[model samples]
Target: MTDQSTVHSVTYDLLRTLKLTTVFGNPGSTEQTFLQDFPEDFSYVLALQEASVIAMADAFAQVTGRPALVNVHSSAGMGNAVGNLVAASHANTPLIVTSGQQHRELVIGEPYLGNREATTLPKPWVKWSYEPARAEDVPEAFMRAYAEALQPPAGPVYLSIPMDDWNRPLSGFDRVRTVSHRVAPDPQRLRGFADRISASRRPALVFGPEVDRSGGWDAAIALAEKLSARVYGAPLPDRAAFPEDHRLFGGPLGMSVKTISDRLAGHDLVVVIGAEVFRYYPYVPGDYLPDGTALLQITGDPAAAAAARVGDSLLGDPGLAIELLLDLVAEGSTRTAPEPMARPRELPQTPNSPLTPPEVYAALSRVRPADAVIVNESTSTMAQQLEWLPTTRTGSFFATASGGIGWGTPAAVGVALGDRDRGVVRPVVGLIGDGSFQYSVQAIWTAAQHDLPIVYVVMRNHEYSILKSFAVLEQTPGVPGLDLPGLDIASVARGFGCRAVEVKSGEDLEREFTAALSAGTTTVIVVPTQPQKAML
Candidate 1:
């Protein structure tokens, strides 16, 4: 028989075969068995909470555009990670999450950290969930998890690894290689789409994050050129996928339904690529587009295309569809590039008091590296910031598509990691609100520990300013429990080994932001503003 001591050694070998070198987790008692015989090539990323672990993995997958590995303890740990897992499911981030399970013998009876349905607990949030039927099947279970996590509309997958499995013999098992299938568009469908666009005098292309994720930028641009179409990024893409510098590229449409309609008016045909038809917030109601407008959507996600508020849905691989469509359309016969939308005028800044959000945004805009990634969660400063620092590219910016707070800070960490490997290590600037920052503030430690260069710009307004705005707009008698008081953001960041500064005015912002970026490591700049001004 193979020696028991070599079981974990073999398990580590299997992990290496899968190329899962990084493991994100918060250790617990039940996980110690799997941690045995740890290999030097495998790195453990310590997160203070399960949420941070899953979130970091989510961002890592997004930036790297591949499946990422994550680990958690028992049921309780899995529960803590559920929220972010849901976000991953929504964003289609492929992740493999393994949680330690009680030993097989103790699972049916009393034991510490035991939960009967540990694997099924996150069923709805994960695309696949399983517990190995036998000790030797654990490694194969991981292979299944990795494959499922990489499927289109990829999402988090869960595996419950029993304690005994870590030390079990696996002499007969073969490590399975995971393969991805390529999806191509139907030639006839592509030709029909091209014919429709070629026949339309005023056509536009609308896009979402999938364009970037699916490597469809060239195809999307080619289709746009074929149709002489104006291309606009989706209402609020979580990240840029299309190049914003292209003349045919228009700006992002915000969450306002009326605003989207106003902007898309006068177009006879709208071709949406790799995006949901529309995503709206705050209950705005109106026709999704102006009267007499027609919408066509091409996406890898069938559900997104089908669920669009208004559109003719074409479900397929966005890149392939665009490539085929480009072949069917004629070369020339182009229209004048539509005039670039006028930039929003910045709100006036008052110098006598705290720095206005717009002033802070303007200063950041000036100092920001042109190619840097901007991860925004500045809820209160959204309007002013958008006006001041308009995203010019499809994939150069990112925000919370799940409408969840706390994603921006850690997501920036993931973005930096993703960029690091591609030799495109642009600086990551996180525009986060103080209230939002608290959601997963522990992520700062990950950034600092990895020596990731990120500038976390905390818009400190001392309140859940978005909620306050809603309360006032509704004319509520009093807004209750909305204040986020007594939070010292700068100190919190510094405690995580990051360079920290507080900026209360434009001058302070200019000096501090410049210094933070130049410091060349994780830094937090707390920009304090009046509550009302922060909301503007």
Candidate 2:
């Protein structure tokens, strides 16, 4: 048992109250004092790199629907973790990220590991960042960090603690406080919003990552059905907010404004929920909406609302807003529900010589468990993956919201662990590209060590196919460094203590993937796939 008199003990007590017993980290010399005599009840998830640390914690927080604690070394470690921190912020994953600082007495002299500009380093990306003014304030700082990380538009928060502070005597104990996570929409505004939807002849609903993040799948479907609306997944969504197979469900929206406006042109009213007004790219020059259409957006993020180019914005918890709209909006309306967008025809089930991405995804879909979770970073083959392997369950799909590669591979590890801890364990399937896999390849060690049931399929296309697609889109020929030759992901996984294999044909992929699904330990299946240009 820890002594309650020390700052460490008191802080741990508060963590226990908050049920944040799972800590993800990579240790360093400066953090040793704080980690001394670690509590037996806490689970310490170790990652080989700080980048993987943040990604793992981000997925854990996303899976368990709770803020996750992350411990890193110092400034150098924080610098390494910044890339994934951007992903976590875009994903809006609530993370309490703490890093150790140099000894208080030596900090003034600029010791070797002192975090110069500690609070400024992780700025803009983090919701809040701070270092305790006094050693006694360390516990209080942590408490405040927890609150800030869990508030609306939840994102990662940072805290820097001096290595010497953990052993400092506690002046007194601080009481733990409960904080509300959701903000309800204004009653008057919501009533008007519902009225607008009810009056629309052809209404459309566009769902985003937040719908799935906020556990609003059922509410979203109900709201859509009540309005007899066509439902489309938001543009470039990081999570699957609707079941692709649902009759009312349309395919994902395009990333460019022109494409989106064209797709929703027929609809008289479009209601975008739980996402930014629009996440556009490639400078698609066009009107934000069609001539006969009106747009309304409900989002938890005020910034998203404010930055929206064309929309009547409402600030509230998107899920709750949808639920409330169900009550206010007229039901059993005579408006004709639009036909669902045509789904891609299923490819031939026969195995191929050099497997295609669609073929691989189809084979996996055939053998994949219904409840399995998919974390994908195979950017070039995303459209194929979504078509062949539809996500039917809530909270079953994860990807990087920042359009960054490398987060998915490590994220799958955390998803499996989080699912296991939450008592709803499901098989985790990682569809990772060869280039994306290499970004944080060391993460496989953490999964292997934990023996998480994750099947990592390395889609080896021997090049950065996504970049080549971009080159194609921009008409930029002869781009250098697009090819990624001589990468053996299977060999790397083996070195990391995972069950690894190389599959050449679709039959072998299906066979190995089926076996890996039931395997107790993590498996890496490296299958060489035909390169395909990505469609933006």
Candidate 3:
């Protein structure tokens, strides 16, 4: 089956076999050669900037549950994509990132556009990085990157291919190769873990992003319900792992270590499924867990498991592990309910009045469809959204776990593409903050071009409200550039070719949102609001 032909044809055939026919990128001069005569079966998704390229790939991969191929320009473009790269790495999204290198002959001269040491740039963030030694090794590198990215603790990998490598004659890579995505736990360890679950008096289950990523949401819910375990989401979860409206759900844990330790104090056993034992922020020194409380984590990341601050870890396929645990626990597990946790309720909104986030989120709760997919980057308003618009569907809600901004806009567009590609016709809603919206504002144009039915709710508070909270918390006074003066989001959306409207009042917010949802096109609803002091 050796092609013994140009590397381009062989790689294209291999990519088609792997079903990685979609490529997202923002091309540059150096990348032109590789992109020339691109195959018809492969569709190229264009983004305005390199940063949006990675964010779009992030959501696309998560939604499809497969590795997404991303192409970017040379060194400068790679630099532009670093923020989103950090976010994707933090969430462990499987992305294969390739950047075009300058001409292979320009090695000693340090030519104008040449990236001398290309592999060093994206390191520590990407799982693997390389610039292939020979032109013929390009396809092999890509296939290896695919397997590396798809492996556990899956993260983005980088490949910097020289511009001329695309045309080199290749061989021995013509056959299709299967890639493995599942890892089963040791039978002895699984049984012991199940015994622990069955023996614990008051157990708690903390579901995480992988529950959505690995299709373990139902298994997580079943385990929680079977043992009357209170379900809490991992801190600042990137995906909704459990039904937020379910009786056993206790909401997301706090990012503060002491806060989390205090919340789960009474539970005798805390079993975290498909998430790290703890992901903390705003470092508050405290005990990792309550005294006498046992913490167990089941995850695919060996690094995370080895580095866990406290407790035991079981490595395996999360979906299968949960199923096994469910079967084992059923033999002898009793039920007991925990005390109900109080959730914040929405305040009543006055007619024709300026809307608050709580009011907008509440109205969204009332109007949001059961199957609508949400891409959230409304940082200051996240608490309100979490409180009012509780997500019930697994994989329905997506956010950045690394606290990166500018991800939602492009991610929404990419999720729309993913849905369309997978033949799922659900509405996509993007919740973006005014500050975050400005970062990747151009992403709106892609949605407009595709006429994707996405409703973008711009929470226009005109300030970096989260940074203001950070200023206060750190006692760093006189922080400049927190307030964004006189920037019109509606005008910006319109400039990007999206139908835009500014909603000043609660009534206007409700009515306009209802109209936008069924508008059959990409629309941006800018809801003006005053900054809320509700800091995390």
Against the reference, the lDDT scores of all candidates come to 0.78, 0.90, 0.86
Q: Tell me how far the alpha carbon of residue 285 in candidate 2 is from the true structure, in angstroms, after superposition.
A: 1.5
Residues 82-133, candidate 2, lDDT per residue (tens digit)?
A: 9999999988899999999999999999999999989999988999999999
The candidate maximizing TM-score is 2
Instruction: List the candidate 1 regions with Cα displacement exceeding 4 Å.
Output: 1-7, 256-259, 331-336, 347-352, 392-395, 421-424, 472-479, 531-536
Candidate 3 residues lying further than 4 Å off, grouped into runs, are 1-4, 330-333, 349-353
Ranking by lDDT: 2, 3, 1
TM-score of each candidate? 0.92, 0.98, 0.96
By TM-score, rank the candidates, best first: 2, 3, 1
- lDDT minimum window of 10 residues, candidate 2: 344-353
For residues 53-111, what per-residue lDDT tens digits would candidate 3 score against the true structure? 99998898988889999999889999999899998998889999988888888866888
Worst 10 residues of 1 by lDDT: 1-10
The collision pairs in model 1 are 240-394, 240-395, 241-394, 241-395, 244-392, 244-393
Judging by TM-score, tell me the better candidate of 1 and 2. Answer: 2
